[model samples]
Target: MTISTEQVQTAGRLWQEHRQAPFPDSLRRAEFGGTDVWVLDLYTAGCVLAWLDNDGILDAENGRILQSCIEDLARVIPEVNDPAGAQYCQQLHQLAVLISKNLASTK
Candidate 1:
């Protein structure tokens, strides 16, 4: 599979879905889709995508930054009241893995 710009755009949009939060509170546990939410899940997904965006998996430290970005998105998007939040999050994650593998194999 090819890593399309659409994938990157989607990932970027996901990150900026909720950009108005102050700071630390940007990634927190709250009710999403009427269920309990956790930033860790979103963080994991975002890190996966960021790894793909960078071409492949990071060594170590930068991977943490990717995770943080996802965490931040999770904290904020829910506040935007998107009902499909979880679904979009999962797609971004799967796309990230797909993109990483696709780009890595081509290298």
Candidate 2:
């Protein structure tokens, strides 16, 4: 149940990439689409991972929060019509799942 060094490294990389991405203005709009929500969800999970990276720990509460974000994003992915957006969601989903698994093991 120990968190692996590789998991921590991967989380760090994902957090860096997430931080570098521009915030989507569509996220503020009331009429936002699946892609917009996807971006927002990714940001949420990235923030959780960032906390883990900074503190070198993932509590059960944050782990639960991360799991919720991942599940919510998964629901939105199928609603995304754009191929590029779908692919992006898929990639993020994979990373999020990995992080979630590692965090779960910590608990």
- Model 2 agreement with the true structure over 50-93: per-residue lDDT tens digits: 55664445666766666766786687667666665555556567
Write down the lDDT that model 1 would get.
0.47
Q: Model 2 clash tally?
A: 0
- Where does candidate 1 stray beyond 4 Å? 19-49, 55-107
User: What lDDT does candidate 2 reach at residue 5?
Assistant: 74
TM-score of 2: 0.65
Tens digits of lDDT, candidate 1, 1-107: 44466655555564555332222332244554453345444555555555545645353554554445444445545464444554554444444444333342222
TM per candidate comes to 0.32, 0.65
Name the runs in model 2 displaced over 4 angstroms: 17-39, 54-56, 104-107
Note the residue pairs that clash in candidate 2. Answer: none
